[model samples]
Target: MVFAPGEKPGSESEEAKLQIASKQIVQNAILRAVQQVSRESRQREAGAGDTPRGSFRPGAGELTKKHEKK
Candidate 1:
């Protein structure tokens, strides 16, 4: 629904207040989801530096070594 400039919802009638509140609730939910996604993306990017890429070598005496016959 479109509104005139400087006009507010729920101003016309008592019933319109319910509709206005519902619209506000939906808009707030969408805004929160967008912000959460943006925050997580930034965190992942920042944490990438803690672990180097392609550097996952197993310990010398780990499972692979134990399984080998003497």
Candidate 2:
């Protein structure tokens, strides 16, 4: 859609191609967003499930068998 000063307009086919390219760019962005949201949802579900998932609350904490006396 960018035109230089004193530049002639593009042909119908050129405009059509530009429109198609723009559409593909928008569609790709939408698809990536959808995938990200879905992945986050799965992580949240895993965090809430019985099995430990993320670092927020990873399994039961272990105690060190060796103790140091100050």
Question: Which candidate tops TM-score?
Answer: 1
TM-score of each: 0.56, 0.52
User: Which one is best on lDDT?
Assistant: 1
Query: After aligning candidate 1 to the native by TM-score, how far in Å is the CA of 31 from where it should be?
Result: 0.7
Could you tell me the TM-score of candidate 1? 0.56
- Residues 1-70, model 1: lDDT tens digits: 7776766875565457788999999999999999999999999899877768876757834667658777
Q: What tens-digit string does per-residue lDDT give for candidate 2 at 1-70?
A: 9665665676446667799999999999999999999999999888678655554653346545564344
lDDT of each: 0.81, 0.76
Model 2 C-alpha lDDT versus the unseen true structure: 0.76
Colliding residue pairs in candidate 1? none
Cα RMSD for candidate 1?
Answer: 10.5
